[model samples]
Every structure is written in structure tokens, then in C-alpha cells.
Target: MSDDGAHGLTIIAFIGSVFSPYYGWSRAQDPFDHCAMNVVLYGRPGRFAMTERKAGSLSRSQDHIAIGPSSMHWDGTELTVRIDERGAPVPRPIRGTIRLRPSGITAGPFHLDAGERHRWWPMAPASRVEVALTEPGLSWQGSGYFDTNDGDEPLSDAFTSWTWCRAELPDGAAILYDVNHRNGGGRSLSLRFGFDGARRDIRPPLPAALPPTGFWRMPRATRSDDGRSRVLQTFEDTPFYSRSLLASTLAGEPVRAVHESLSLGRFRNPLVQLMLPFKMPRPL
Candidate 1:
């Protein structure tokens, strides 16, 4: 019985439980489980997720990351991710937006309506990314030189976390897409899938279970005399049961950029059980 309210949010808490030290080092007062949601879209380029992360004290001040609905000038290609720092009292919202192109080798421009704004470049020396939709969702696989700001000093304090994600198919296909993350000296391997029908209350002291049977693949990057970084990554796809994988990746708000092949699973709205079986996911 995995309760969605273990820490506070779903994604962060879920990942922290199964894998130790969830996302970087989190303080007791600043738990990473604040209020975070991960959303993804099955597009032609690949699966893009919009994850909203609010790590402050109050939930009302929770920031948002979303792909704004097609408007007049901008459409799907343009993504709007808002990181608002709501102040005291009425909680002011500081939002932002990001504009991306279809090119797989270029970086995108990010604009913050409030907080910080900058352009983020893609991993250099791009690799061929192949994605296929399997019934319930889509599956993808790719490789590239992940950017890294090695710990040189205070000014050069940036780390580009690198990894891969493989999601299972919906309708229960048994094949699981394993995601691997390598950062610093620590690494995390998790499965972003569905709840196995065994739901629980959305409150404290929540219980959860990490999916069994998943492996990690290590990749080494090499550079040629021509200044092209070539990557050789290896990932092992494991099956949970005999055939019960996810369909497509879940949808929420975008968080970080990920590279992997994911299978979106069936979306069982717990909202329907609000009046009967289960409870709603806290508040928005």
C-alpha cells in the first residue's frame, strides 16, 4: 500500500523512499518532498515531461512548471514553466516560460516572468534517439554527451546530472523501462510506473513498495580528434512479472530534462474514488 502522501508530494517522496537521498541533499526543514508533480507528453521528438516543484514551507506558495495550452502566437513547441516565489501573507506568484525548437541538437531559450531566466543547451555530440509507441504508451531509447559543470570552485558550481529512463507499457505488458541516474559518486535507478491497484490513504506514515527487478547500465563517453564526443551506453530492460509493464509516462508538471525510453501506463484516476474508495491528491 503505497500512500502518495508519505512525505508531502508524490514524485519526490516516491523516489526518495525507494532510492536513498532522493534528489540532492535535502534538509529536514527543506525536504525535497514539498509539492512536486511530473507531467510528460508523447511527442514526435520524444517524451517531454513538465514537472512542477514547490520546495518551500507552505503549499500555497508552490511554484508551477507547465506547457501552456496552444495560445495565439505560441503553441505546443513553446513550453511555459513558472517558478514563482510567493511571498508572505498572500503568496505572490513568480512565473516564467521557455521556448524550445524541434531541433534535437540545439538548446532552448528560457524566460522567467519572475525568478531567474536563462538558456539551457542540450548535451553536446547528440546521438540518434528512437522512440516507438506500444499500445498503452510509447517506448524510447537514445544516447548523448550529458553536460557537466565539474566542481571547480564556487563560481564553477554546476553539475549536469546524467542518466536514462525506460518506462513499461500500459495494460500491463511485463516489460519495464529502467531509468538510471549518475551524479557525483551517487547513482539512482528507479521505475516510473503505475500503482499495482493496491491504493492507500493519502496521509502521513504512508507505506509504499519499490518495484522489483530492474537493472542499471553504465555508459562511457569518448572524444575524437575532431572534437566529437561519442557515447557508449548500456541499459538492461527487465520484466516484472511475465508481461505487465506500463503504457505511457505519467503527466504532471515538468521538472528536469531526462533522456530515456518510457512506456506510459494506464492512468487510474484516484479522483473518482474520492467519494467512495480512495481520496483525492491533497490540493492543487
Candidate 2:
């Protein structure tokens, strides 16, 4: 997200893109064979690009990851990203560079399901990001968050759905993870991390209701002081997921949070999977 909240971007480097129809059909194949650098720009003339490449187009190391024309590297201090991709369905350019400097990195390996098949890590709960895009010519600096998730089994094997939110507070960042399992149970994780590398599990605020996404109407909400949150902006709204900017009170302080609601159940639907290719095409 931009410092002024006017521009925002999401770049997801995927090795076995969970949303790829190619990966869906080749589940028994090598994960690296179905990879992509998923990029989403949220501003005027917004764009969405995800080009699934073959195994020969992927590379990785201790501090770097490259998928096709885009790559990201961490050199102890700042993480640098280079992007060179074109939007699908119409093919528009989206080339850019992003630099993220984490205020602090945290240690996390939390389980999101009872079977311990899925894990999540809040690598850096607080940071600053600079998004400089040359293709569309947009640039901004803003507060940011970084995290990673991995699973021994497919996500659909464990989670039915989940809601996550990350709010930057005066001192640090607060995050909430609510997960519903396939077997009819769920878990909630509430955590606070300081910009100075301090982290602690905290009592989550009361649950607040918010309006659903306009197109998908995907259920969305957050933890807040009065159990009332409002939608500030809806960034991405797909059949199975929604990302939005939310305004609410947390820990007695008014805060703006980046929230996401994902439904793996919907993702598993054959029709939804078929429709994904329109937005996530694989370029051979």
C-alpha cells in the first residue's frame, strides 16, 4: 500500500500457484513445474497479471527468488523486487521495482489446521515499501507487511476458509488470523509485534461486521473495539477471495487495516477453477 493510500500493489511469487489450473491438473507433478509471479496493481487503470511458467523458468536461493521475468532478493537490510510482466486478457505492461525495508523480522511457524498440514509465518509484521512502476509510471512509499505460508498438503485438504487482518499501530503491528477447518472446527490467533523486534500474543478485540465485497460478496470482517468496522476500499474481489482496506478501532486506537477473506471451498469448485484461467493464464 502507498503512504497516502492512493496506490497499492500485491506481488506473489508462486511455485505451484494454488490458483493455477495447470497446477490443479498436474497435482502429482513437480511443484516447480507450475510457477508464476502474480502481480496486482490497485489504482487507476488497475491491472492483474499472473503468467504460469515452466520449471525451466524458475530459480531460487537463500536470499533470492526468480520466476520468469520477475525476481526478488533480500540482502540483509532491504528486499528488492524487479518485475517485468504484462497484464492478461488484453496484455498491458506492468514493469516496476519495489523495495521493502522491514522495521523488524519475527519468528513464526504457526499451524493453521488441526492436521498440521498448513503453516504460516509473519516474517515481518511492520515495514516500509516503495513501489516505483515505470510501465504505468506510478510511485509511492508506504507502511507494509510481509508473511509466508506453506503446507504439506493442499490448502483445500485442511482449511475451508480464513479471514486475516493486519493493522499497523502507533508502536507496532497487530494481526489476526481466523481459520475454519474442513472437519468443522476453527482457530483464532491474535498477535502484536513491535517495530523494534518485540512480539507477543494478545487478546484479540471484539469481532466487527463489515460490508461484503461488491462483486463477489465474499464475507468480510475484522476485530475492532466496538464490533463495527467499515470498508474504506475494496482492492480485489474474486470468486473465492477479497482484499480490502478497512477502518476500525483496535486496542482503543483508531486504525486502518489491510484485510483478506479467502474461501478455499469456493476455490475447489470446478466452475471457479475453470474461470480462474481467464485471470491467470499460463504463457507457454
Candidate 3:
């Protein structure tokens, strides 16, 4: 997201694209062989692309990683991402470069699951980013964020669904993670990270249910000060997942946040898996 909340971009490099049909039918060995660089640019004429590649197309170094023609490199001061991909279900060119500089990098690898098999790291809760794209003739500078999540087991085997959001604050960022396990237990984490590298665990207000997506009807919820939140916009609406822009009150202040809801139960369904290939086309 940009400083004024007008432009937003999301990029994720996956080592075993959990949403991939190719990975679902594989023998489950050599996870590295199933990889992808997923990128989505938001605004007028928005674009999305996620094409799973093979290990032969992946290259990794201490500060650099490349999958296919897209790559991300960190030079100690800033992270630079070069995207050269085609939007799926349409195959239109969606090339670009994104640069992110963090206000402060948080120390993490925070546990999510009880067994510690799943983890998350808020590397940069508050950051600044500049995006320049040629394919769509887009350019902007704005406030942004970066993070990483890792899980030893597939999400479907461990979770029923989850809701996550990061609320921008005056001096830092407030984050919430609510995870429901398949076996009936769940956990919620609410924390604040300052731009000066301070981390504080916060007791979240409470879960406030928001209306479901109009198309997919994916369930939605988040926490707020008044115990109420509303969807400002729905970005991505898939059969199993949804990303929304939310207007809510947190810590007694009004906040505009990015929210996501994922239903592993829907994702694991064979029918939904078939639908994903249309959006995340994988070329063998």
C-alpha cells in the first residue's frame, strides 16, 4: 500500500505453491521443484499473475532470489524486485520493478501453530515503497510493508481457515493473526511493531465479523476498538480466499487496513483446485 492508500502491490515467492494443481498431484517430494513468483498490482487496470515454475528456473543467494524471469534482490539498504510475468487467465504482459526500504526490520519467526510447525515473521511492519511498471505504465511512491510466512506442513492439513490484517498506525503497525485449526483449537495474536524497532504484544479488542464477499461469499472478520469493522473494498475474490481493504477502529483510532481471509477447507477441495489453474496457470 502507498502512503495515501491509493496504490498497492503484493509479491510472493513460493517454494511449493500450495494453490497449485501441479503440486497437488505430485508425489510430494522435492518441494523445490514446484515454485512460483506471484505478483499483483492494484489500482485502475489492476493486474495479477502467478505461474508455477520448476526448480531448474529457481536460483537463490544470500541477498537475491530468482524464479523464472522474475527476481528480488536486497543490497543491504533496499530490496529490489524485478517482475516479468504475464497475467493469468489472460496472458497479458505485467512487467515491473518494485523497491522497498524498511523503517525498521523486526526480529521474528513467530510461532502460529501449537507444535511450532507454522511460523511468521514481520520483517518490516512499516516501510516505504516505490513502484514503476512499464507494461501498464504505472508509477507511484507510498507506505508499504513486507513479511514472510513458513509452514512445515501443508495449510489444509493444519488449518480450517484464518483471518489476518495489518493496520497502519501513527508511529508503527498493528497486526492481527487469527488461526483456526482443523482439530478444533485456535489461537489469535495481536502485536504492535514500532518504526524504531520496538515490539509489543497487545491484547486485541475482539473479533468483529464483517460481511462476506459478494461473489465468492468468503467469510470475513477482524478486530477493532468498537468491536465493529466494515469492508471498504474487495480486491481479490477467489473460491477459497479473499483480500479486502477494511475501514475499522483499532486502539481507539480509525484505521484503513488490508485484510485477508483464507479457507483451506475450500482450497483443498478438488473442484476449487481445478478452478485455481485458471487464475494461476502453470506451464510445464
lDDT (0-100) at residue 54 of candidate 2? 91
Candidate 1 has a TM-score of: 0.20
TM-score of each: 0.20, 0.96, 0.97
Q: Tell me the spans in candidate 1 whose CA falls farther than 4 Å from its real position.
A: 1-29, 32-34, 44-171, 177-284
How does candidate 3 fare on TM-score? 0.97
Displacement of the residue 20 alpha carbon in candidate 1, Å: 13
**In candidate 3, how many Å is residue 35 off?**
0.7
The regions of model 3 sitting more than 4 angstroms off are: none
Ranked by TM-score from best down, the candidates are 3, 2, 1
Candidate 2's C-alpha runs over 4 A off are none
lDDT of each: 0.23, 0.87, 0.87
Better of 1 and 2 by TM-score: 2
